[model samples]
Target: MSKVSLKGLLSSRGPSALRSLRGGAASALSDGERLAMLDELEKSGLGWFWASDAEGRLTYISSAIAERLDVPLADLLGQPMTTIFTAAEREGRAKSLSLMLGAHKAFTGMAVRATRRPDGAVLRLAGQPVFGTGGRFAGFRGTGADISEEFHREEETARLARYDSLTGLSNRHRMAHQIDSTLTAFRAAKRNCAVMMLDLDRFKHVNDTLGHAAGDELLKQVAERLTRAIDRECEIGRLGGDEFQVMIPDVDDRGVLGELAAKIIAMLRQPYSLDDGRCVIGASVGIAIAPHDGVTCEEIVRAADLALYAAKNGGRGQYRFFSGELENETIFRRRLEQHLGEALREEQLFLRYEPIVDAAAQTVQAVEAHVCWNHSERGIIDEEEFAQIVEGSSLIGDVGMWAIREACRRAVLWPDSVRIAVNVPVPLFLSENFVGEIEGALTEAGLTPGRLELEISEAVFFGETSIVDRTLANLFKLGVRMTLDEFGSGYSSLAYLRRAPFDSIKIDQKLVAEAERHDSRELGLVRAIVALAGALQMDTIANGIESAPLLAVLSDCGVRYLQGPIFSEPVDQDVLEQEIADGSWKIDPGAERTRRARRRTVFRKIEIFHDDYAYEVTLRNLSRTGALIQGLANVPKGTQFVVDLGGGQLAVATVTRSSGDTQGLEFEQSLVDDGSGGLCTRNRVSPYALASAGTPLAALAPGSYQGMVGGLIDQGGAPKFGYAPGGRGD
Candidate 1:
């Protein structure tokens, strides 16, 4: 190695610097002797010395250091220093090592990496600018010490801090930091982002039944699947336990987000093959878009959380988009949960059995027990309330057992030919007293065990399966009829059917709806399920057959038990007793030939745009495909308008039916759920779109559009149609 140049600095600083450069003993040595000592130091491996010419290309480097880098000293001599060493990001003393060199200034302890080393060696460099005889800049001379060991230790520590040990995905701290920084950076750019929050449904059941190790494996599999399912760029993190968060950058369309959310849910719902056994769990997704939901990480995460809770309460296995009403809905659900126990105590909880008629005989062969609540404040609480309050509450076990006993008590009074199928929640089915509760219900009612069917979902398989198998065996010995509910929905297993003693299998309602929708492989799955059930000597039950065409199709596929609106809605015991008093009940299916979408009654005011004019109308009822509005007069069939359903939700609709001042509208684009039992357009009119019209980029406020207002009011245009005169109806 060349001698570290000290003569230029010594001449600049005079005798004091010379004395400082050479210690008392070394001062007696000549310049040649001092250079010899420096050469010996460079030969040692403790550290290496390097000198670059004015062009920043390496002129002289220790041959020992070149050996470590696995390059010949001659090859490194002419190469740029940047090619050999690059600044380490962890120690950003300068933006870059090249910058300090460009400034011709001194730098010390700047961490760097060896570019060609297979061992990934790290080095801490200290350097100062060198000058020649004329005081003109020459180049740089630097000393570098190996720091690879320390650097690796710190890097492993950081990896542990930022990643989950189980899933190897980002932990909570990393997720929070990434979300915060991304939102802060995107704020000025006005770019939108979406966050999806998910938690495994019945995940606790898995932990309780299988071991925690199995649960860990399931989480790893879930993380892998999540990584594969996302086609776009995203950051997925596990926020502890079964909860996960996905931050998708630069996407705000509810249509796109909703589809992605649904896709994630579907992927997560698939059965996981683990060491324990086949475990099937579900996921619920709650999404929130940035700037609209919140501008900060905490706000968006909280919003997504609220939406997730709503999805769980609404019944698991669904995705819900966040809205302003989520907080209120959450509070309402909590209140209902608190009152559910009282409702049970006061006998407000009751069962309504929807008859499952035999497809071939057209006779009521069995009825499924559906629980309903009679809340004093809400009059008659619907099934939605029951799902959000009763089933989701801590008292699920108590409510579930009560329903079993009550259904038995009621079924005992029914005709012997008809059976009663009661849904068994996973927690209650796994409870220690589960078998005893069923035995007690049967004994107290003095009902035949075979007449009371226990409809168990596949989630029951996710728990300590030995106990589950024992429970099933005991129930079988007790002669309690068992039906596998929603078998083909997610947990599609021939092993469960072969091992468990199921008297029948329940077809998922989705397949039935799909059969009504189209002639696709979904129907093939149904036929296969029916065929398999037949070979197993088990009957098949198809639920949610709402239309005549669906009923005919299911009948052709050999489904024995049929239930849905095509027959009748769930009725109270009194009505059932009256219908089957003569010990025989047969009913005709409805005359409806095709399936129709269910409409939600919503009497709210909305705006409709026609030919640049806005008309105020009262929205009577809304569905995914259509809505009814009554306000403007003389709007004939085939007329088109843009309907605004608030929150920037706009749908282009054409009038399909017309009456005096009342018209039925068919939406070109379907609506999506707002997580609050309301319908909204799939895609909203973005504020960025408004910016093109000279409006500022911001969140859409709750009101009519400013552009629409100017055109409707300032133009002095005549009214398009005469408004209905106000009377008591207004």
Candidate 2:
């Protein structure tokens, strides 16, 4: 019915080819000429003809198409049409190829990919069923042309539309579409999905200090690292600037989510080597689970945002699960940010000094100055409580310079042997007057340059090569010693050490803890750092040595300076003066300085449920990992009990040790800090869940949940383990 004239007699390749077939002599050419022209057209690489028998076997295929497909015409002639063309989407071309052939119907414009073409050679095909004189159906005769070039162009355009050009990760639009589609499908199936929001810390600082080129380079590296870090099934995307989103399907357990978040943070925190210089950055993660946190995309995203804000407020480089209280916490952080500038103006801030000691001699080497706020109403707030808040403030430069000046002013009054060290913030260290400010502080207090130490982190290296190099050279010539603060917390690049004249390396405290807890490769890394520092004629300091095991390991590993609560907590100037008033202060290596997991002794009566029976118990002690409860008799190990810790909190725990009237319960999921020096569950049973159980989500009696959840009302028998007289609270 439809016809296209041969432009050059044509050619065949991947699809089908015209062999001995001839078109109707519609033109002025004779039948032989017309047939010759059609054959020439097939060989011109434009189009080809193919025919199949009644059994759907390729009965004839032109030599041009066979040559294009890299097969002999004889080989392609007898192959099944379905076997000759295969596609990834078997639903369309492949399925229809089989179905349409069997249906004995004409099909036009069927696009399919050749089975043998790894280059994804596509062909547009049109076919008509052939019938004999008796009207018995034969197979199909068709013409197809390769459309690989056009297909690849359209695919590239679509990829550019959905992917980030800079990072090659999914773009914001694609991520949003994916989240929406996944959540919708999952909602009906009653499955859980989770969303994680991650924002890079100090990314803008990198852009401001280094050039935009460096920032772009940093983002690409980040994408690669993120891909490697997230081994689970998920989609990672860049949602513009330094923000990223991760959609994880079929995950709702906060404990598992916490570990994954921690892994990502750890990976991102490692220092990155760039052409500009080596730099280290961190990420804060906020997570929200579907249906549990929200039922819609908007709701889930907002929940994740609130959680992210809370993580930033808590200190960057941490993860937080969404909770109802995060909304209020985010607002309070905003209020706190506004008040920070006021705190500075009102002189509500003070300084405390924590000593970094030479562990072998048990003598103080240097005391680092820290900022503390004495709010008129909120009492005292430490640096950890407000660090991230200050980092985001416009007054970071002012605050950094103040700490340096104040530390010098106070240290000038101490004995000459007691050197003072001050922390340098990223923004302040990059400011124009950074070196000038330090010089003025030293001059004003009559403090010798040698007696002052500048503690700088890897973040300072984000500046331009010339600027960072110039700044370091100027400071080194000024006669002050420099220490790399929080080493291994971020970019632990040996590249920086190769050039920067740091007098010492302060190992990140968390690195030490992680190394000791797991005896992981981190311990080897710590040793390598110590060896490297020793070779470079630099000292290595490992802080936060809490336990005896940790201290012993660090000591044996040749760490030069150790600082932790085990040595002495940060102290007021008055306390420091009292300790060193006579001579050089010395602390003997004693068991008292190291920290042990703090257990709070509690004598409160609570309820524990087992097998739908509730037993009144007295809580003897509580810790983050576990709890001890009295008032149960003959409780066997491995039994699970839900502890009602009052105020709608329920903790799932298992009995690890059972003695006569007391049981030590190990929590299935560890407790999280409640921010008031207490422990609480990360997530609580929501009112919606209660409502789903047939009760209205309103103000019900204190014990109303017991009947709905524990079936306590239906139980008329005594509990399995009755309360014993000795287990009662005194």
Candidate 3:
């Protein structure tokens, strides 16, 4: 193409003209033509334009350049380009000019800013150098545009991405990225850092009860407070909905970090002024230190999370540092979770009976069934070790059902007068299906609802009060007695005491245990709790009574019941039953001996009949209370019988109670001694008449009586005889 034609095409083209200039006809133009071509290019609508000679002087300047500087083009031509730039841009522009003139190379897309002479409007300029005629630097030409608006837009977009729109604080995404980068830098430098995860405790309640608008205002205020508390060296972020993260970079001493955390806690301790004039909320902080507690971002976050859980679990609004002990506890908890399914399926869980004694009666009133796990290797694990695992897992409801069923089954075996209290997990208490499970268990076990007591921890009351009220109301409707466990440990003391349908409140061991040891605040606390329970017309059971002094204190405090090792240790069901029987059983020689002789005669023959199928026997020495058969064969209880007399005569007999080979039989009519000693006697004389002879038959011997009566009493205590029919033995 001709030089003028090429220059016209390049000028007519846009930024794409630079690509064509790289290796095409635009390079074949003469130096003057290139300069003239550059001069013509300045008239294009893009922006200011300029041309430089091979000597690095300004050869041509377009009217647009003068207009950008607010000067005439005739006054700007033939001046070195460096003269047009400000002192700041002169050196850079001069270097570009030198490179173009010395090496015949072209440069493009060099961004520079210039100020207009009169109005001082800021203008962005981009320049390119042109070469021609034996590879000489003919001129430098470029365009510029006003990009202030574009620059501002880019900055605004970046700000929105990094900051939370609601609170105007860094969001979790940006915080995470910054923390990760900080950790990487710290690791390379072998430095230490700390991360704090904060949870606004009970913030949800405020939102639900007060309103979301109020909650939003509260969060904004919290963010402001946090920002003011932290310095430029530290960064704070809102990790979505009442949770926040703080990063303290380059922390060498952990104590310093702790002090900082303490400061944060103290700052949060001051009440937050919510939109609702005076409502306040508190925050819990969990701290994890890098290189000490964790080495990676995830590890640090997890450690902080665990510490946060510990803080909340220890009753919120506090701060805790990640420790080795907590890590070990976490591992132990994971192990428990791993094995919990098997434990539930294999029936490895059992109950221990903690006796609840009636302080007034000074007798064992009832036993509370405390579930325990008999781990094969770990021995017995405490509730704290596995209860949370059960609660946090889907197994909570299943485990609760199993506990209720097993407790009911074992409880039915207890003496009818003694009620058995079983601890129902808090989740079970909240579940809608809890009442159905209890009803089903009671039906299957044939246990009365009055005999079964369900114990629930005080934590349930501290939860959603509405939920607690509804759940407890349903449970009460099921006729199950409810005892509030760990009564004084929760916040909603008076509220729960007034609202819940609790039959009793067991004083938490903490207050009771300290009541005897210390005479100060703890004693007063216990006394207050007892007084509260009493005022509410609810029974109070003093727990953790280890010493007589504590019991005495409990008694003095007017506590109705006491539980702990002081009265009786938690024992197995069989052991508890044996203990109760041992304490209550009496020995009577005369009555026992007579009963035994009759029982032995009856049982021995019953055994013979059972072994040989001999079904008939004669009962002599009959009385209103009992009857003895002299020529009777052993028969099982419940067997119908017709006693044959003489000719077509007959007497109907029914087995009432049996012992081994002998059976206690009831006849429709009492057998009377005819005194004739004729056919009625017939080799079977009444044992009473024989005893009167003073040469009583072997059936009337005291030795046989003792053996039979003893055996009968033993069998009577068996669970299988729950509803055995009584029999009067002659």
Candidate 4:
């Protein structure tokens, strides 16, 4: 019967099938017969068919339709199809029916659940619309099928594809699509947007300690927290393990983006309770805004990635924004790094020496060696441009060591009295081989420790005092004098001043220039520093004394050493030696002598003793009396001590006060010991020594008697004594 039914359907092609089902051929069928045939067909198969008029009223329904709806055919026909459909299906079915009628074609795959009448048995409908003869819009008919299992299977597949299995949130694939679409819309609208890529810092630590399951739970919780943190205007997506991306649309102010980044950082900083509240993780975020950081998707992603790298480099638990300056700086640094390796190998680097002069003495006491690079094509590259790159690399230590060695070698060529002060990078000081390098340089150059002063910027003493202390101690043990460079510009910790093994401090040029302006604050600061340095027994070098007024001011402040362009520009070794030879390089010796005299006058006497020797020292005159006594360790009290008064005169001294190692003496007698008694006698004890008999011993180095009794007497004014004792008469 099934085969006969199929054969009948196939043989009666086109509209003949409908006509055959009506009873016979189209010419023999009546309308009543056709309707009766449709009813019979519905009873024959599990499928159902329905015919609706143009107005959507059912003119006829198969018996199967009545069975599917659990109703009689009479009750189903001549009724609106809406009665058989749910609210959603009613609209869908109506649209399908209208489309099929308008197109005058059969429509299929209209699915719905319908209840049979009386018994109320449920059936799934998959139906099609039917066209009348000559392609006229007539009615709709289709089959009903059971598809409950199929519907669930399709939904499960979609769920797995779109969501993260662990967090139930949109995964990377879905988020990427969403981001692309959103960005396209933003671009079309000419609106600005931002993309933030975040990575959880130290997330692995939690996973390793708490297991992968706990890690999964933590990620789930993190997703929820992040979603809650963002506003509805933003979309958050998980870009796989420990990384997330957020898209912010219609953003106006970048500050708001920064604020959002800060907020995210803050939120992430809060402890994440996982594994029953035992695990925690922090997050770092990098943000890139459109039309500024980048224009296209790839560019934005790359910018965000760079920003992320910067954030991680800056340290975790923070956020950074993409900046054009940062990008340029990064590129510049990379180029510099690439060139720096070759620069060292090619010996493109050289040293420039700036003389550290004693302003009062007008002598080059030391030369500060500064590093300079003469690029083959770029001409001169300033230190500020590449200093940071050098500092952050291993090259800093190597370059610093090289500087020390070169400076020492050059220093050995200078006068024995000239010291070379080499600037040392802080990292070099911390290097384990720093001491060895210094020793090697010293040995190679045969430079004395006293002549090799290490000038360190004040920044070195700021961190890890113990390390600085140890480094200073090691340098001191090597007999290397330390000078604080750029003194006032740095932290200038008083504690470091007291603890570090520093022998001198160079007043920064800024302070010195300000002091020259008659700036009270600056001058006062300089004075205070000078006083402090004096108290600490540290030598003070006033740097950047450019103007004569400033020099005068420095002199008044009792600054003994100074270096600047006003005095003498930094000259090459040959020029410096020529200047020294010409005697035109003379500085005012009077100022330095005056300063020393003042300092000496303050001290009563310095009785230095070696072993069990003692000498009674007497202060003759502060301006000219020699500071040292030779027989202080052996001469007895009350013995006629004939002191050699330089140009062949003898000054007799008697001990007046005697202590264990110190003694006070008085000039008791004077005589010409050159076997002559005339004024021109080679040796003569003059009245100047007698007049200075009661003076304190401290004034001896710069005493007036020596100035008067020296070989050449200044007879322009009051008759100065000839060859007075303790003067540079010889």
Quick one: best TM-score, which candidate? 1
For model 1, the run of ten residues with the poorest summed lDDT: 709-718
lDDT of each: 0.79, 0.77, 0.61, 0.60
Candidate 1, residues 456-475, lDDT tens digits: the string is 98777766769989999999
lDDT of 3 by residue, 617-712 (tens): 444444322445544334456654444332112344556876643456565544332111111211222223334445243433221221220111
Error of 3 at 376 (Å): 5.8
Q: 246, model 1: CA deviation in Å? A: 2.3
Expressed as tens digits, the lDDT of each residue in 1-730 for candidate 2 is 1222332223431112233244322356654575576668778876688777789888666666666667656666677888887653421324466776778888876767667765556777778887766999867778878776776777678788889989989999998899999989987776788999999998987888777999999999999999998889999999999999999998866667877888898899887788997677899998888876787888898988888877777767888877766777677768777887888899888998898888788889789898888887667777666566676677878888888888999988988888998888878888887888889999999999998999998877766678788889899999899999888875667878987899999998778887785468889989988999999999999987777778888988999898887787789989999988876889765765556555667788887766555567889999888899987788878777777775445777878999988999987777765433346665545444555565433332233345332223322332344557744322
Q: How does each model score on TM-score? A: 0.83, 0.81, 0.46, 0.38
Higher-ranked by lDDT: 2 or 4: 2
Error of 4 at 595 (Å): 46
By TM-score rank, best first, the candidates go 1, 2, 3, 4
In the order shown, the candidates' Cα RMSDs to the true structure are 5.2, 6.6, 29.3, 32.1
The best candidate in terms of lDDT = 1
- Name the 10 consecutive residues with the lowest summed lDDT in model 3: 674-683
The residue ranges of model 3 lying beyond 4 angstroms of the native Cα positions read 1-211, 214-237, 246-287, 295-299, 306-342, 358-363, 375-380, 457-471, 508-522, 544-556, 564-570, 583-730
Question: Candidates 3 and 4: which is better by TM-score?
Answer: 3
436: Cα error in model 2, Å: 4.1
Q: Which run of 10 residues does model 2 get worst, by summed lDDT?
A: 8-17
Candidate 2 matches the true fold with a TM-score of 0.81
Ranking by lDDT: 1, 2, 3, 4
| lDDT (tens digit, per residue) of candidate 4 on 484-590 | 87666423557668778789988877677778667568889889888988998898888755556777899888776787656554455576666555433554423
Q: What is the TM-score (0 to 1) of candidate 4?
A: 0.38
